[model samples]
Every structure is written in C-alpha cells, then in structure tokens.
Target: MGVYNVHERLLVARSGEVGALLDTLSSGGDGDALWPHRSWPPMRLDRPLAPGAAGGHGPVRYTVTTYVPSAWVRFAFSGPRGFHGFHEYVVLPVDEERTVLRHTLAMNTGGPARLTWPLVWRPLHDALLEDSLDRAERACTGAVAHPARRGAYTRLLRRLLRRPPGVTGKP
Candidate 1:
C-alpha cells in the first residue's frame, strides 16, 4: 500500500520566524518548539539536524537524508520492516507576514505494515501531525485559533500503545 499524508498550517508570521522552526527538530530537551512533545513522543536524532543523522520517535525510525537550514528537512524511513520512503517538513512563504508550514509523509507499506498502516499507524500519525501544527501555530502566534482534538478511538489507541513508565517506546 502506498500512503501519502500531509498536514499544514498558515501562520501570521514572517517566513523567517516560521522557517526557523524547521531547524529545531529533534534538538532534544526543551529546544524543539515545533514538535508536540508534551502529548506525544519526542523526535530524537542521533546527532544534530543534518544529512545522515538518525533516530525517530517511538517505534518508527528514520534517517535525515536532506536538510536546508531554516527551510526544509526530509527523513527517509529505515525501520518497522515495511515503510519505504520519506517524510518532510517545509516552510513556504506566502507573503511578508504569512507563512505556510507543511509536513508531508509519502511511503509505501508492505508486509505487516499493509495492515498496520491503515488500522493503527494512520490514525496516530494524523493526530500527531495535527498536534505538531498546533505547536507551530502556538509558537508563532501564541495561540491556536482551532486546536486539533483526538477522537475517541485515537485516544484509546494511544492509551493502549503507551509504554510504561521508564520504558522507552511509543507514547
């Protein structure tokens, strides 16, 4: 199965201001303002944001294959057995005081992922990206006009998939 997913938000901020968020992915600690670490697993890279840096949140794993500071970054999947392709975040300038922050996940699933992608991964991935965009909006404008809320099934899935305290795994 081939899966193509995208999530984006338009923020009333300069492109430079919104673009800087791209440089902060997986910085760890409290430095990453674009990922919603408070509600989801934090994205962690093996090294700083750059080509070849590896790591991912939860059970998914990928490696940074391309990066343009303050503009864009792409991560190619390397694990979970069946995911093949990349996910990327890009900043698009709409005007002097408007910017569109977009994330795209394009991949092909085989093996078990053929089932898991639609049943489990897709819901979680959608919610996570929405939360991520909420973070971006909040960081840029100090508020979110309309926050994304997880559905009942997604909440249940998260509860069921959450790792125990001190155990390293999906949220």
Candidate 2:
C-alpha cells in the first residue's frame, strides 16, 4: 500500500482526445484482443460500478482488470517470484483535458527482491511504463503507425476460404 515511484503529468496541447485514448486502452481490454472490444457486451469488460459509470469521455464505472498480453502476465509472474497481483490505474484530469495515467505494479513482499526494488524494480518499471505511455500517446494522436488493423470474423473466414492453393493446403 506504500508509494512505489508514483508519477503524474499533464500532456499540455492534448487532453480531451488524449483522455479518450486512455479510457479506450484502460477499459477496452478483453481476454482476446481480436474481438470488437470497444463495446458493452459479455465479451467486453464491464466497467466497475463502484464509482459510477459516468466518465467525461464516456460512460463507464470500472473494468475487472486491464488486459495485458499473455507475455506481460508471464513476465510479471516469473520475473517477480513472490505474491500475485498487479493492477493498473488510469486517472484522468478531474477538470482539464489531460489524463494522469498510472500503471501501478504492486505486490506483497519483504523478500530479497523487495530490498532491491529501489535499485532494480524502479528502473525496470520505469522503462516498461514509458513504453506503455508512448503507445498510449500514439493511440491518442491517431498515429499508431502500423499494427495490423482489426477486421470482422466473417471477413477473415471468407479470406481464408478464398485463398489461393499455395496460400492454403489445398491442391
């Protein structure tokens, strides 16, 4: 529960859309990234009903947990060998357009690693969080350069069926 390298900043020239971007990333995490996550359905995360589902960018109360890739989960599980839970927090400006994003990776411990958190964990966490923020910024700015865009399931099925012989096992 103690502080672990907390940071807060304003993105200046960008705030509203930026805030929207943060909300999208924080709330749109479904176990499967391929699905149409930006919606309110069984597949999509249900925002936490604790605070209330009214957000400046949109309506949402809470999400069960932000979706990190299996790889991230694996790293969190293996790299730190004690305790088990690290949740993220996406804080938006209460009044301004800027968003205050916090990815607090926490755990319960008093082991050797805990002793070295200042020296080791801080640096590791810093780098990881930096990458996360950078990506979030890209999504905010509509400049996510290149990562294959999502398409409908039926479209993919059709494409697979229409593939040339060389593209598939058909002869």
Candidate 3:
C-alpha cells in the first residue's frame, strides 16, 4: 500500500521566525515549541540536527537525509520493517508576515505494514501531525484558535497500546 499524508498550518509570522522552529527539533528538551512532545512521543536524534543524524519517535525510525538550516528537513525511514520513503517538513513564505509550515509523509508499505499502516498507524499519525501544527500555530501566535482533539477510537487505541502484553485490565 502507498500512503501519502500531509499536514500544514499558516502562521501569522515571518518565514524566518517560523522556520527557526525546524532547528529546535530534538534539541529543545521539554520546551520544544514545535513538536508537541508533551502529548506524543518525543523525537530523538543521536547527533545534532543535521544530515546523517538518526532517530525517530516510538517505533518509527528514520535518518535525517536532508536539511537546509531553518528552512527544510527530510527524514528517510529505515525501520518498522516495511515502510519505505521519506517525510519532510518545509517552510514556505507566503508574504512578509505569513508563512506556511507543512509536513509531508510519503511511503509505500509492504508485508505486515500493509495492514498496520491503515488500521493502526494512520489514525495516530493524523492526530500527531495535527497536534504538531497546533503547537506551531500556538507558539507563533500565542494561542491556538482550534485545538486538535483525539477521537474516541484514537483514545482507546492509545490506552490499549499503553498496557503491557499479557496484562489485561485491573488485575
């Protein structure tokens, strides 16, 4: 299966201001203003934010393949068994005080991922990206006009996934 997902937000800030957020990924600790790490798994890189740096969140693993300072960064997936492709975050300048922060995930899934991608990963991925966008907007504008909320199914999945294998409910 081929999956292409995109999430974006338009911030009322300069491109330079918005783009600088790219540099803070995995480096800003708990105060990372762009990645929504408080709610989801934090992104971690073995080295600084540069090409060849490797790391990912949770089960998804990737290596930084391209980076253009505060403008763009791309990661090529290297694990989770069947995902092949790249995901990237790009900053586009719309005008003097408007910028678009976009994230794109394009990949092909084979083997078990063909099933897991749709039933398991997609929902979580969607929620995570929206939250990321909300963080970006809030960091740049002081607030989020509309915050992303996880659906009931997503909440249930998160709860179930958090439990240890062979452990069921309240023992």
On TM-score, who's better, 1 or 2?
1
- Which prediction has more favorable TM-score, 1 or 3? 1
TM-score of each: 0.96, 0.40, 0.93
Question: RMSD in Å for candidate 1, one decimal?
Answer: 1.3
lDDT of each: 0.92, 0.39, 0.89
Specify the highest-TM-score model's number.
Answer: 1
Cα deviation in Å at residue 169, candidate 2?
29
**Which candidate leads the pack in lDDT?**
1
Error of 2 at 149 (Å): 29
Q: Write the per-residue lDDT of candidate 2 for residues 63-158, one digit (tens) a residue.
A: 233333211111122234442444344445545555555555555545665564554445534543454555555555544444333235434433
For residues 11-122, could you state the per-residue lDDT of candidate 3 as single tens digits? 9999998888878887746656688788777888998889999999888899999999889999999978899999999999999999999999999999999999988888
List of clashing residue pairs for candidate 1: none
* Decoy 1 TM-score against native: 0.96
**Count of clashes in candidate 2:** 4
| Least accurate 10 contiguous residues by lDDT in model 3 | 162-171
For candidate 1, write residues 1-171 as lDDT tens digits: 889999999999998998788788999858998988888888999899999999998889999999999999999999788999999999999999999999999999999999999999999999999999998999999999999999998999999987778885353
In Å, residue 90's CA in model 3 sits off its true spot by 0.4
Error of 3 at 53 (Å): 0.2
| Regions of candidate 3 where Cα sits further than 4 Å from its true position | 163-171
